[model samples]
Target chain A: MMRLLKIVLLVCLFFGCDKKAERPSAFLQTQQIKLAPPRVLTTSTIIDSSIVLSADFKMEDVKLRYTFDGTDPTENALSYKNPIQITEAGTYSFKAFHPEWTPSETTTVKIYQKGMDTIAIQLRTKASIKYPGMGAKGLVDHKKASLSFTDAEWIGFDTIAKARIDFGKKVHLEKITMAYLVDTGSWIFPPENVIVYLNKTDSIRVQIPNLKSDTLALADVEIPIEKTVQYLTIHVQNLKELPEWHPGKGLKAWLFMDEWIFN
Target chain B: MSYNRRSFLKQSSLATLGLLSGPFYASAFSSNNNKDVIIGHNSHRYKVDLGWGMLDPSKTPVNDCHEMVQDSKGRIILLTNHIKNNVIVYDKSGKLLETWGTEYPGAHGLTLVKENGTDFLLISDFERNQIIKTTIEGRPVLTMDYPKETGLYTTKNSFRPTETAVSSNGDIYVADGYGEQHIIHYDGKGQLLNVFGGRGEGEEQFLNAHGICFDNRDVHNPSLLITARELNQLKRFTLDGKFIETINVPGALICRPVIHKSEIYFAVLRSKNSSDFDSGFVLIMNEKNEVVSCPGATAPAYQKGELQELYQTVRLFQHPHDVCIDDDENMYVAQWNSGQTYPIKLTRV
Candidate 1:
C-alpha cells in the first residue's frame, strides 16, 4: 500500500511540476522602446537649402550617427546631436545607426530654387501630402519633410485678410508673386476653384480660371503684385468638391507654396 | 473552454495536406459534369489609378482589391481598401471607368445584384461595422445597422459583416466576418430573419465566418447557406439554422466560393509558402463531395524552396479575397493587399 501511494505521489508531483512549467510567467523579461520623432535641421538662409537629418531613441543608450553623401556614415560624419548643413540642391540619402537594432533611415530631400519667403505651415488635422506633379505618391513622407519656417518673412496678399501660418513671424511690406504649379497633361487633386484674398473681405478675392495643357503651361496662373501688400489670405473654397474626372471619391485639401520672397 | 492547441495543429496540418494533395488538384481542373468551369491564376498585373483626375498629382495607384462584381451592363466593380476610397468601377478591359464610396472609410466586402433590371451594390463597411446598399451611381439606398432584434451581439457595432450572398428571392445572408463571428440573415426588405454560429471550436461554430453563398442548384430543398469557415473548414447549413455537413479542403485558406451551373468553384488564397504564381486556385467539386479537378495546377512535388524562385509561373495566388462567376462561365477574382488590386478574368477554353 505504501509503495502504491509513493508511485501515485510521484506521478502527482510530475504532473504538478509539468503544469507549473507550462504556465507562462508574468515575469518574462520584456523591454519596449518607443521610437523617437524624426530630426530635421535647416539653415537660416534659403540659398543653402540642405537640411541635416537624424533619428535617435532617447531611452536607448546607443550612439547615433548619420551621413550626408552616398558614402557610409562613420564616426567623423555628422553626429545625431549636431546640425548638418545641406549645401547642394540634389537628392541626398541619410542613414541613422543604433547598435543591435535595424538602422532608422530616410531619403535625402530634393532642393528647389528659392522662390519666395518661408511661411510656416502646420496641418490642423492629418492633411493629405503630395508632390506637385506626382499625384498621391510622394505624400507618404510628409512627416519627414519640414514645412515650418524659422525666420521673419513677408507675404503679399491681393487684399488685407487674416492669414495663419504655423510657426510663422510677420515681417515688413513687400511685393508678392503667386504662381500655381500646374502639370498640364498630368492630373491634380482639389481642382482649381481657389480664391486669393489680401484680407478677409470677399471683394478683394480673385478666382483662378481653369486652364488645360493645350491652352496653358502647368505653371499657368501667375499673379503679379502691384502694391506692397501685407496679411496674405488664401481662400480654398469648394475644397470639399473633387475634380470633374476625379477617379476617387473622397475629400482632401492641401496648400502648396514654394518661396515667399522677403524685402 | 480551453483552446486545444495539439488538436488544432493536427487538424490544421491534416486539412492542409488534404487540400494540397492530388485529389484537390483533380477537382480544381475538372468540371463537375456539364457545368462550365474555368480556372486560371489570379494575376497581380492590373492596377486602379485613383489619381486619374484628382488635384493632388502625387497619389499612388491603388493595389489591394478585396472583392469584385460585374454590373448589369457588364462593368467590373472593385471593392478595395488600398486608399480612403473603398469602391472603384472599371470596364471589363481593366480600364478605370469611375470610382466612389470614400465615405466608407473601411470598406471590405462588395457584391453587386441586379433586381428589377436596376443594378444595386451591397458593401460591408469594416470600420463602421455595418452593411449598406446603394445604387450603381453611388447613392445610399439603404443601410442596415447591427440588428438589434438579434440579442447575440455584445458590442454595439459587433457585426463586422464581410462578404454577402443573395438568394433568388432577395434574401441576404451576411457573414459576420471580422466581428462577433455570426452569420446574420435578413429578408429582402432588410428585416432580421435569423442568426447562427458564434465564436467556438465546436463543429457548427466558426473562428472567422468569412464568406457565405446560397446554393440554389438543388431544386427540391435548396441549401440556404454555404460559408468559408476560415479555421474550421467549409460548412453548409439549412435556412432554419441546422448544421448539415462539413467540407474540408485542408491547408487551403479559402476566401470565397461561388456555384455556377451545379458545379462549386472555390477560391483558395495561395498558402504563404506556396510557390504557385496565381496566389490562388479554383476547385471544382462534384456531387459526390470529391474534388474532380484543380484548374491551373502546379507540379505535385517541386523542392519546397524552389517554388519561390519560380513563383511567377507556379500557379500561385497572392491573396485571392473574393471570387465571382459570370453568366458566360467566366471566372473573376479580386486579390487584397497586392501590388495591383484589379480583377483577373478567366474564360473557359
Candidate 2:
C-alpha cells in the first residue's frame, strides 16, 4: 500500500509541476534596449565644421547628457534642450538616461575646421496693389504685402511706399510670382503694371492709376525667367487711396511668395 | 481678362492641328524606298486611365525603366536612374526578372554596348556627376569623372552627364544634361576624345539637353548626334560640333528621344491647359519624316472646382519623361508624376 501511495504521489507531483510551468504568470518581466544613437547633422566636409545634434525619446522625463571630449558618460552631465551646436573641431560624445528606464547608449562624432562653403541664393519677386474708392477703406495694408528672404544677409528689400520695393545687391534671379487673396466682388485692372527693377540703387515704387475697389479677382501672377540683377525693385504704383478708408474697414491684402535660385 | 474657355480651346486645337501638319510630319511619314506606308489622319486617338497598373505597395523597390537596350541573349536590360532601385533587367514582354543597383545613388542615365563579345553597361550618376562603366553583373570596370584633363568643364565637378550613345567603332558620347549642357566624347576605354555645346540659346547651344542617340539610318552621311532640348525642340547634329537641322515640335515639351528599327520615338509632356502643367504624349516618327503614330496624346481642360483639374484624355500621358520601344514595338513610358510612379507598358494594337 505505501509503495502504491508513493508512486501516486510522485505522478501527482510531476503533473502539478508541468501545469504550473505551462500556465502564464500574471507578472511579466521584460528587458527593453535601444541601439540607435541621437541624430547629428554635420557639414559636407570636416573642414568647415558645424554640427547640430538632437536626441528625442518617448519615455517620460528622460534627461540627455553630453560631452565634447571623449570620456566615459556620467549621470551628472549637462542636459540638452535645443539642438546643441559645435563650431570647434573635435570629437563629440552624447548619452541619455531616465529614472524609470535603461540609460540611453553613447554616440561619437568628429568635426573639423573648413573654409566658407559657397551658398547659392535665389531671389523671387512678389508685387501686388490694392485700392479703395472714395469714402472706403484702403485695399491691402503695407505690412501684409512684404517679401521674406531666406538669407537676408545675401539680399535685402526696402518698402519705399505702400506700393514700391527697393532691391539690393546683384544676384541671379530665377523665377517671379505673386499671390493674393481678394474679397468677394472685388477686381484688379491692368494687371500688367507689375515691373521689376533692373539696375542697382534707388527705390522702385509700384503706381496704380485708375484703381477701383469692391470686386473679386484671381490675383495670382507667375513669370518664368532667369536673369542676373545687381539691384531689383517692384513697383506697385497705380493704387488710388480713398477718403472713406479707415483702419478697421479698409481693403485687407495677403501675399505669399517662394522658390528662388541663385548660383 | 475674362476666362474664355471656348476661344481658348478653339485656338489651341488649331495650333495643335497646324503643328501636326508641319513639314517634319510630311517627310517623316512618307515612303520613298518602295515600302508601303499607311498614313492615318486623326488615326491616333487619346485615352487616359488615371488608375492603371499604378497600384504597387508604397516604398516597393521597383526597378527604374530608364532606357532599354537589347542584349545578346535577346533580353531587354533597362538603364535606370537608380534613384529608387537601379538597373532593372526585363524580358521583351515587360516581365521583371532580376534587379541590381541599390548601391549607386542618383543613377540618372543608362546605355548598353557590346564590345569584343562582352556586354557592358554605362551609367551616369547625377550625384557623383561622373560616368561609370560596369559589366553586366554590376562590376565596375572603368569610372570617368569630369574630364578636367581635357580643359572642357569651366566649373569643377559640375558635369552632370545624363545619357550616352556608342558608335559602331566604339566611340562613346556622353550628354551633360543637368550641369554644363555639353556633350563629351570618349573612346571605348573611357578616354576623353572631345567636348562641345555650352549654356546658350544659339544653334549649337542647349538649355537642358537631356538625351542623345546615334542616327545611323542615313546612308550617305550617317551623323551621330541627337539632343532633346527641354524648353524648345529636338536638334540633330554632326559628330563634330556642327548643327545639321532642327525639328520643330510645337505644343510639346520634349524630355527624351530614342531610335529603334529606323524609327524615332520621343517622349513629350503636353500641357492639358494653358496653365503650363504637364500632360504627356509620345510621338513616333518614321524615316520619311512624318509622325506615323502618336500615342498618349492628351488635351487640357479645367475642372469645375478642382485645383487645376488637368484631364488626361484617351491615350493621354501624365508627364511621360522617358520612353523606350521594345523589339516587338511595345512602348514603355517612364513618368515623373503619374499616379503610379512606375513604368507603364502600352502594347501596340
Candidate 3:
C-alpha cells in the first residue's frame, strides 16, 4: 500500500497536476469575436437607370447598417429595414452589427448609371451549347450575371466569340464597357484581348491583364471608343491555353460574357 | 505515521481535482476566450482539430481526401485520390495504423456495410468507371462495371460513377453523378434491376446527382436520398424509383448525405454563389428534415416554413466532400482539392 501511494504521487507530480493555473495575459485585448460581413444581394453594379439595392443577414437581432454616400458603414449609419431604390449612381456599403459581437467587415458595391441603348445585336460566332444563355439578346438585356457561370446569364465560349452591335443611328459614344467572368478553378478566364471596331477603318483594342489570384470574380473591361458610329463589332479572344501553373494547363480556357454596356 | 498517511491522501485528492477541472473550465469559459474557434449553432457546436489525421506527406501523400468511414472496431478509414496510398486507416485518436490500395486513382466515394458479421467497403472509382467492393483488409471481392443493361450510355467513359448506396438486402444503387445523371440499381447478384433519373429540369430528374444514400431510419418506409448538387436540393425517392419530396438547401452545394442516429449530416462542398470559392461548411438536419445547425457558416433560419438561403459565415472548410460520424458523435471531414491536406476532426462540445 505504501509503494502504491508513492507511485501515484510521483505520477501526479510528473504530470504537473499541482501547478497553479496561470491567468491569461493582461495585455491581451478583450473584445468580442467579429461577425462575418453581410451578403450584398444587389449583384448588378452597372444599371441602365434605376435599381433596387438590398442586403440580408439572417441572424436574430443582427441589423444590417448601410450608407450610399461613398462612405464606410458604422453604428451611426442608417439601419436597413427594407430594400433601397437607387435612381442615381454611387457607391454603397453595408456592415452587420450586433450588441454582443464586433461589427463585420464593410462590403462595398459600386453602381454605374450611364448605359447607352442598342437597337439590335448579331453574333458572328455562336456560344457553346452547354452555356447557350438567353441568346444574343442577353448582352443588351441589362441583366448582369452573378459570378457563377452556371447562372445561364453568361454566354460561354471555348473559341473566339464575336458580336456586332447596331445602334438605331450614329450617336456620340465615349467608351464601351464589357463584363466577363473570372473563375480560375472552373477553367474560365478573362479574354486575352477585346477588339472594338468603331467603324470599318478605326478600332481600339483592350488587353486583359493576367490574373494573380485563383479567386472567382467578375470583371468589366472598358474600351475607349472616341468616334461615334452606328455599328460596332466586338471580337473577344479566348485564352487559347491555360497558364502552366494551372492544373488544366495546355487545355483551351473558357470565356464567359454576361453583358455589354455602351456608354 | 498516521498524520503522514492522511496528509498524503489529501494531496492526492487535490491533484485529481486540479486535473479534472482544467478542461471543464477551459470550455465553460471559452465564450470569453478567443483561443478556441467554436463553430456550429444550437446544441451541435464543435471545435475543430486541424492537426487530426495529419500524416507525414513524404511517406503518404494525398491529392484529395474524398471520403471517410468508421468501421465497427472504431477505426477511421479515409479514401484519397493519391495512388501511392489510396486508403489510410487511422485510430479515433488520429494515429496511422495501416495503408493499402494503389489502383483507385479516382477514388471518390466510400461506403461500409456489414453482412454476415463481416464489414465490407465499397469504393467508387470514377476514373476507372467502376465500383469495386473489397474486404476490410484490401482484398477485392467483386467489381461492377458500367451499367450496360440500362442502355443509358454508348461508351464506358460516359458512366463516371461518383457515389453508391447499399440497401439492407444487399441491393446496390450507383449514382452516376459525373455522367448522364442516372441512378442504376442492381440486385445482390449484380444483375441490373431498374434505372431512373436523367438530366432534366423535371421533378423526377436530377441535374448533378453527386451522392445517394439509403434512408433506413423508418425501417418499414425506407427510401433513397440523392443529391442534386447544382440545384442545391436533396431529392427523396421511394424504394423503387418514385419521387417523394425535395428538400431545398438554398445557397449550399451539398456533396453527400450521411445519416447518423436521428439526424442527417452533409458536407457543403461550396456555397451556391459564384464569388466565394472556398465557402464550404457542414450542415445538420433534424428528423423532420429541418436544418438545425451549420458549422463554419451562418445559423440556420427559416421564414414561413421555407429555409432561407445559407452561406458561409466563417471560412473554416474548403470544398469538404464527405463527413464521417463515429459512435461518440465526433465528425471527421474529408476535403477535395484543399491543398492535399488530411481530414479534419470536429469534436463535439
Candidate 4:
C-alpha cells in the first residue's frame, strides 16, 4: 500500500511538472471512451464463387481483427494482415483497436451468390445520384441486398423504378426475390406495392403494409415463379407521403432497393 | 520589438500581460501557413489573416475569446473571460487601441447597441449569472441580476444568462441560454416585462439557447432571432416572444446571428457528426435565407432542395464563436478553446 501510494504521488508529480502547451479536453476524453467499430467492406452480390473481403479504418495506427463464422470479432481474433479470401459464403464482421483510441464500431458484411444464370436486365429510369444502387447491373450481380440505404449497392428512385430482365432465350425460373431498406428518418420507405409481369397481360402483385416504427429495417420479398417465360419485368412503387411523426411529414418519400435475384 | 510578436514571444520567458508561465501561449497559427492563408467559397471568398490581433500574451492574454462587435467609429471590441482584460479594443489594422475591465470572469456574450448617439454594450457573464450594461469604455452603468420575477429560477446560478439583445424600442431581452433557456424581457429600466420558453424539444422550447439578436431588417415587422445550438436550429420570434419560424441548418452548431445587408453572417462553433476537435467555419446566408458560402468548409451542397450535412474542409478556424463583419465586408472571428489566441481577420476577396 505504501509503494502504491508512492507510485501515485510520483505520477501526479510527473504529470504536474510536465507543462505541455496542449492537453486533452473533456470532449476528447469522452470520445476516447466511446469506442467506434470498424467497417467490413464487401459487395452485396454473391455468385457461386470465391470473394475478397477487407476492413476500412480512418486511422493508420488502428489494428483490425475479423471473424467469418457469424461471431463478433474480438481482440484475440485473427489479426487482419490482408483481405480475406472468402471462398465459403457467410457473415464477415470486424473490429478495430488502437493503443490510445477506443475500439471502433462493429461492422459486418453478407456474402451471397447469384441463384441463376444467363439473364440480361435493363432499368427504364436512371437511379438517383446519391443512392445509385451501384447501377442497374447490380440487380443481377448475384449480390444480396443490404439494410443500409446509404450503401453503394442500393438504388434510390425519386418516385418509382421499373426493371425488365431479358433471358435472351426461354428459361425456367422458380423464385423472384429483392431486398429493400426501410429508414423513415431519411425519408426512405418500403414500396407500397411490388408487381411482377410474368408476360404482358397476366400479372401477379404483392403489397407492403404501412410501417409504424422509425427504426431502420430490411424487407426481403420473395415470390414463387412456377411458370417458364422469356422475359420478366418488375414494378416497385415508392411511398407517396411520409408518416406524421417524421420531420419530413407529408413530403414525398424515397425508395431504396438492392439487387433483384431471379432463381 | 519586430512586428511579429510571436517571434519575440518564442525568445522570452513565461512573463507578460500580468500572466504567469503556463502552456496557454502554445502555438496559434497552424504549420501549413500557405494553404491556410486563403479560404472560403463562391463569391464570398476571403483571404485568411491568422496574424491579425496577435498580442503579447504576457501583457494582454485572453481565454475563450467569445464575441466581437464593430462600433460606428469602426473600432473592434473583443470580449474575453480572462480577468486581466475582459474587454480588448482594436483598430481595423489589428492595432491594440485599449483594454479594460476585470469584472467579467465568464465574459461569454457581447452585444453593442447605439442609443441616442451613444454606444453601450450588453455583457453577459454566465459565471456571475448576470448581464451588465456598460459604456464602451468599461464603466458599469446598469446591473441586472437573475430574473426572480419570471419564477423560473430559485437562485442566481440557475439563471445563467448567455446573451442579450436590445430592441428598437430600447427593451432589453435576455436569453438564459446556459441555465433555463428562457427569454426574459424587460424595459430599459430593468423591470421584468415577460418571460417565455424553457427546456424541451418543441418549437417553443430550446436546448442550449446560446444567442439572441433583434432582426430589424424587416422594418415593419421586426422580430428576435435565437439559437438552439444542440438542434442546429435558429428560432425567430416576434418582439412579444411569439414563435415565427425555425430555420434548420443541419450540422452547424451556430453561435449568434450577425446580420449585414442582404445577408446574415455568423460563426459556426462546430459541426455536428464531426470529430470533436475544432471543426468550425463561418457561414453566410443571403436575404433569401439560402446559405451562399461557408468559409473554411466545403461549399454548401443541397440535394432535392435539402442542404446536406456540412463539415470542415479547411483547417482555418477552431471553434469560431462569433463573427463581426466590418463596413468593408471583412470578417473578424473570435474563437473558443483555441490556445488563448486572439481574433483572426478574414479580408473579403
Candidate 5:
C-alpha cells in the first residue's frame, strides 16, 4: 500500500510540473510583436508642385505618425491628424501606434519631382484591352500606380509601346524618367530597351537591368537629355521572350508602364 | 511511531499542495489562466493553439492543407493536395486517428454530408477534373466528371471544379472556379440538371467562383452562398440559381463559406490582392452578414454599410484556405502554399 501511494504521488508530481515556463501571451508581448504597416494613400507619389498624402489604419485609438527626414517614426513624431501636404521631393515614412499595442511597421513612400507638364500625348501602339489604363493621357496624368499591376493605373502592352508627348513649348529638362512594373510572378517584365528622341533629332537609349529576383519591384528608367525640347517621341521595346530561368520561358513577356516624368 | 505517522500525513498534504500549485495543472483546469495568445475582436475572440494539429512531417506529410470538415462522430477530417496522405482524420483533441487516400492529387475541397444515418464525404479534385463521393471510411461511392451536357465546356480540362454543395434533397451544385467559372447543378442520381453563372462581369456571373455552401438559415427560403474571390464578394443565389443579393467583403480573397450556428466563417486566402502573397486571415460574420471579427487581420469596420478594406494586421496565418467549425465552437484553419504545414486550431475564448 505504501509503494502504491508513493507511485501515485510520483505520478501526480510528474503531472504537476510544467516543462515550459509561464511566459506572457504572444498578444501581450509588446516588445517582440509589431503590427502590420499602415497604408499610405495618395493620388500619386510622383508629384509636380504639391501632393496630398494620407495615412490610414483600421484599428481605433491608433495614431498614425510620420517623418520626412528618413527616420523611423516614434511616439514623439508628428501625429497625423489630417492629410499632409508634401511640397518637396523626398522619402516619407509612416507608422501606426497604440498605447496597448505594438507600433506598426514603417511604410515608406518615395516622391519624385517632375515639374514639366505635357499638353498633349499620343499613343502609337495599342495597349492591351485588359489593362488599357486611363488611356494615352494616363502616362502624363501625374498619377502613379502601386506595385500591384491590377490597380488599373498601369497600361500593359504585348506589342512595343510607343508614345509621343508634346510639352506645347520648349522647356529645359535634365532627364526623362519612365516608371514600369517588374512583377515576374505575374509575367510582367521591364522593357528590353527604351529609345527616346528629343525634338526628332537628339536620341538616347536606356537599357533596363536584368532582375535577379522574382519579387515585385518598380523600375525607373532614366534617359539623360540635358537639352530643351518641345516634342518627345519614345519607343519602349517589349521583352520578346521570357528568360530561360522563368517558368514561361519561350512565351512573350508583358510590359507594364504606369507613369512618365519629365524633370 | 505516532510522530512518524504524523510526519507522513504532513508530507502527503504537502504533495497535494504541490500538485495544485503546478502551473500546468492550473492552466489545464482553468482556461482563465491560460497564457496562450488570444486574438479576434468583439464577442468572437479565440485562443490560438498553433501546435494543436502539428504532426511529424515524415510520418503524415501534408502539402497545402486545403480544407477540413467535422464528421458526425465528432472527428475532424483534413484534405490536402499531397497525394501521399490526402486525407487525415483527427479526434477533437488533435490526436491522430487515421490517414487515407493517395489518389486525390489535387484534392482541393472536402464536404461532409449525413444521409439517413451514415456520414459521407464529397471531394473535389480540380486536377483530375472530377468530384468523388466517398464513405467516411475512405471507400469511393460516386464519381462525377465534367458536365458535358451543359455545352459550356469544350473539354474535360475546362471543368476544373473547386467546390461542391449538396442540398437537403441530395442535389449537388459544383462550382467550376478555375475553369469557365460556371455552377453546374445535378440531381441525386448524378444527372446534370441545370447550369448557370459563367465568366462575366454581370451580377449573375462570377469571376472566381471558388466556394459554395447551402445557407438554410431561413428554412422556408434556403439559398446558396458562393464566393467570387477575385471580386471579394460573397454572392447569394436561390436554390434554382437566381441572384438574390451580394455580401461584399472587399480586400479579402475569401476561399469558401463555412456556416456554423448563427455565424458564417471564411478562410481569407489572401488580402488586398492575390499577388500579395503570404497575407491571409480568418474572417467571421454574424447572421446579418456583418463582419464581426477577423483573426490575424484588422478589426472589421463599416462605413456607410460598406465594409472597409481589410488586411492582415498580424502574420498569424499565411493563405488560410478553409475554416471548419466543430460542435465545441472551435475553429480549424487549413492553409494553402504555407510550407506544408498542418491545420491550426482556434479554441473559443
Candidate 6:
C-alpha cells in the first residue's frame, strides 16, 4: 500500500507540473543571408532619347549606392542622391546596404534606343473584361508591369491571345521579350507556345512551360528571332489544362501580359 | 473534474505531431511604448496598447491568435492553435487568470454561446477537421466531427471548418470556409438541417467564404452575413440560404462579421490584392452597410455610391483575423500567421 501510494503521488506530481512546448526549432531557425537585390524601375519605355531609373528599399535606413562604370556597385561606390539619368548607351548598376540587414546584390540595367515606329496595333482576340488593355492602344502605352501581377496595367487572356504590333519602319531586331505573371493558384499560367511573325513571312514557334512556383513571379522570356524584322506579331497560347496536382486542374488557364518588349 | 494533465499532454503531443504539423515563428517584442499610435477614423479612433496581453510565451505560447471572445464574467478568452495552451483566459487589465485546453491543434474559430445563463465555447479545429463545444472551464460536452450526414463532404479532409455562428434558438451554422465553401446548418442536437453556398463567383457562390454570422440588428428579422474575401464583399443571405443582397467594400479582404451595438466590424485580412501578404486593416460599417471608418487603412470614401480603392496607410497589424468588441467598446484584434503574436487591444478614445 505504501509503495502504491508513492507511485500515485509521483504520477500526480508529474501531471500537475506542465512544461512549455516551444515552437519547433526548425521553424525558428535563422540564417544570415544576403538580402534581395534592389529593384530597378526604368522609364516606361527604354526606346527613348534618355532613360530614367529609380531604386528603392523597404528599410528607411538602408543607403543606396550606384556606379555607371563596369565595376559592381558597393558601399564605397557613389551614394545615390537622386534618380539616375543615362544619356549615353551603357549599362548602369545599383545596390543597397544596411548595417543590420544583409547587403543587396548589384542590379544592372541597360539603356537602348529604337528607331522603328509602330504604325498599327490590333488584337487577334480581345482581352477579357478584368484585364483588357486600353482598346489595343495600351500595347504602345509605354507602361510596363512593375512586379505587380494585378497592377491593372497588363492585359490578360482567358485561354489565348494574339496581337500584331505593326512596326511600319523595319529595324534590325534579334530578340523579343514578353513580361508574364505566374501564379498557378490564381489560375494564371504562362504561355505554352509562342508564335512570332516577322515581315508577315518568317515565323517562329517557341514552347514555354508553366513556371513551378507558389509565390508570385514576374517572369520574362525572350525568343531569339535573329533577323532584321519588319512587321512583328505575337501569339500567346495559354495552357489548355492545368496539371492534376493543381486545384483548378482540367480548367482553362489564364495568361497575363504587359508590353511586348522589343530588343 | 480532476485535471489529467499527463493524459492530455500525451494525447495532445501525439495528435499535434500528426494533425497540426507546420513551421511557425514566434516574435519577441520589447516592452516600451505607452501609446504612440492611434488608429481608426472619425468617432471610432482608438489608442493602441501593444502590452495588453504580454505573457511569458515560454509557459503560454500562441500559434495564430485566431479569435477572441469575452465571457460574461468579463474575462477575455483567446483561442490559439498552440496545443500546449489552446485557450488563455485573461481579465480586461491583461492579468492572466488561468489557462487550459490542449486538444485544439488547429484551433481557428471561437464563439461564446450562453446557455441557461452558463457560457460555452464553440472552437473550430481546421486541422483535425472537427468543431468542439466546451464549458467555460475547458470540459468538452460536445465533439462534432466532420458532418458526414450533410452529404457535402465526401472525404473528411474536404470539411475544414473555420468559423461557427450559433443562433438564438441554438442552431449552429458552421462555415466550411477553408473547405468546399459550404455553410452547414445544424440543430442543437447536431443533426444536419441544410447545406448551401458552394464554390462560384455568382451572388450565391463564395470564394474563400471565411466567416458567417447572424445579423440580429432588427432582432425580429435576422439574416446571415457571409464573407467572400476574394471578392471583397459581404453577402447577406436569408436564413434558408437564399441570397438577399451584397455589401461591396472594395479592396478590403474582410474576415468574419462581428457586431457590437448598431455597427458591424471585421478585420480586413489584406487589402488592394489577395497576394499582398501582411497587409490588413479594420473596417467599421454603419447600419446602412456604408463603411464609416477604416482603421490602419485609408479613410472610407464613397463617390457616386462606388467605393474607391482602399489600402493600408498605417502599418498597425499583419493579417488580422478577427476583432472582439468588449462592453466598454474597446477593440481586441486577433491575427493569423503573424509570427505567434498575441491579441492587440485598441481602447476607444
Taken over the whole model, the C-alpha lDDT of each candidate is: 0.48, 0.49, 0.79, 0.74, 0.80, 0.72
The stretch of ten residues in a row with the least summed lDDT in candidate 4 chain B is B5-14
TM-score for candidate 2: 0.50
**Against the true structure, what is each candidate's TM-score?**
0.45, 0.50, 0.80, 0.56, 0.82, 0.63
Off by over 4 Å in 1: A1-263, B1-60, B272-279, B286-289, B295-315
Instruction: Please state every model's RMSD to the true fold in angstroms.
Output: 23.6, 27.3, 12.5, 17.5, 13.0, 12.5
- What tens-digit string does per-residue lDDT give for candidate 4 at A1-263? 21232233234333432244233211101111222345455643374667678765433356888887889887798898787777775667787765433354456665654667667888977778767766888776766555556567778887778988898888787878777777665678888888889977968898888876554555667777888888888888888887776666787788888767777
**Where's the lowest-lDDT run of ten residues in candidate 1 chain A?**
A26-35
- Candidate 2 regions with alpha-carbon error over 4 angstroms: A1-161, A164-263, B1-65, B79-84, B154-156, B270-273, B298-315
Instruction: Summarize candidate 2's per-residue lDDT along B63-163 as a digit string, tens digits.
Output: 33345566677666665554455776667655666667776665767777788998988888867878889898888888988878767666556888877
Candidate 5 residue lDDT tens string, B1-349? 0111001111122122122223333333223333344679998888776556667777998978899999999999999988889999999988999999999987998998889989999999999999999999999999999888888877899988899999999999999988899999999778998899999778999988999999988889989999999889999999999999988998998999999998899999878632335668899999999999998788998998889889887545667899999999999999876666678789888
Model 6 bad stretches (over 4 Å) = A1-260, B1-35, B274-276
Docking class of 6: incorrect
Which is superior by lDDT, 2 or 5? 5
* DockQ per candidate, 2 decimals: 0.01, 0.01, 0.09, 0.02, 0.09, 0.05
lDDT, candidate 5, at B16? 22
> For model 6 chain B, where is the 10-residue window of minimal lDDT?
B1-10
For all candidates, the clash counts are: 62, 46, 0, 21, 0, 0
**Candidate 1 residue A14 C-alpha distance from true site, Å:** 72
lDDT of 3 by residue, B1-349 (tens): 0101001111122221122322322322233433455778998988776657777788987878899999989999999999999999999998999999999998998999899989999999989999999999999899999988788788889998889999999999999988889999998767899999999768888888999999999999999999999899999999798999999999999998999998999999877752445568899999998999999788998999999889876445667899999999999999876666788789898
Q: Which candidate, 1 or 4, would have the higher DockQ against the true structure?
A: 4
lDDT tens digits by residue: candidate 6, A89-204 = 55678876755333555767654444234547789887888777555665555556654556777777886788877667767787777767776656777889999877456888
Better of 2 and 6 by DockQ: 6
Return the interface RMSD of model 4. Answer: 20.8
For residues A1-263, could you state the per-residue lDDT of candidate 3 as single tens digits? 21232334334334433235333221111122345567787746766567788887766668899998988898899999998888877778998876544566677776776577655899999899989898898887877888667888898899999998889898888887788888777888899999988777788988998765464667778888877689988899999988876666788889989888777
User: Which pairs of residues have clashing backbones in candidate 3?
Assistant: none
